[model samples]
Target: MRLNHALPPDGANGKPVGKEGDLVVRDDELGALGNMAFDLHSQLSTTGDLARQNTFDAATQLFNDGLEAGSALTVLHDAWNTKLGTLKEACAHISNHLDYSKAQHAKDEHDIQTGMKNAAGKAMTVSRIYDYIK
Candidate 1:
């Protein structure tokens, strides 16, 4: 059988040349996910900032004792913001990596197709010679 013709039309393992798997990150889907992560980070960070400002304002209006509580709360707020930043970075990284993978897969598929075509052409040449000799 011709090597080129024997394989699936799309590519190896039934996947298309540059398509993403259901479990793997897709370009469009991952982009959306990254956007959502950014939006969440923005919204949450803004809310946290406003809440902290309001609490501090209220505490200062009340008495001197509230300063210590506000100081303690700052630690928790910083930690939460740090975590949200990490999450946003991770989503962006995933989206970028998947986009790179899709391009690489396409290049690899093209190489495979070229190799198979060459092999098939060579085989045909040899077979034709043998048939002519007989």
Candidate 2:
């Protein structure tokens, strides 16, 4: 039986291999990268906002139509009669896109949360790309 804790029999140095380089942000290049990331996220978020609005409108119509029928049973019946799979797929796509946007936003926010030196009133971390750049 072989022991799992046994060291390598030959050319093995047990020390950690290499240093992960510290990313130094050049103010100019960092600014440019930050701007690009912010713009991409903002555009994605805006698109999601529009899509969310459309969803609200459609869902409201569905709800209103369901309610307009005379009986509570009709409302209950309509609720159960959903094409929920199709709706779930649509929502999943939107949610996936929103998650992507939030990921980009979170990268900058992580910098802020780590107490990086930045601009004043930078607490709206997701929206403030300038604070995160340098």
Q: In each prediction, how many residue pairs overlap at the backbone (N, C-alpha, C within less than 3 A)?
A: 0, 0
Off by over 4 Å in 1: 1-66, 117-134
Q: Tell me how candidate 1 scores on lDDT.
A: 0.57
Quote each prediction's TM-score: 0.44, 0.30
lDDT score at residue 107, model 2, on the 0-100 scale: 80
Q: Give the TM-score (vs. native) of candidate 2.
A: 0.30
Stretches of candidate 2 exceeding 4 Å from the true structure: 1-24, 67-134
lDDT of 2 at 109: 70
State in Å the error of residue 16, model 2.
8.1
Clashing residue pairs, backbone N/CA/C < 3 A, model 2 = none
Query: Any idea what lDDT model 2 has?
Result: 0.50
Q: Estimate the TM-score for candidate 1.
A: 0.44
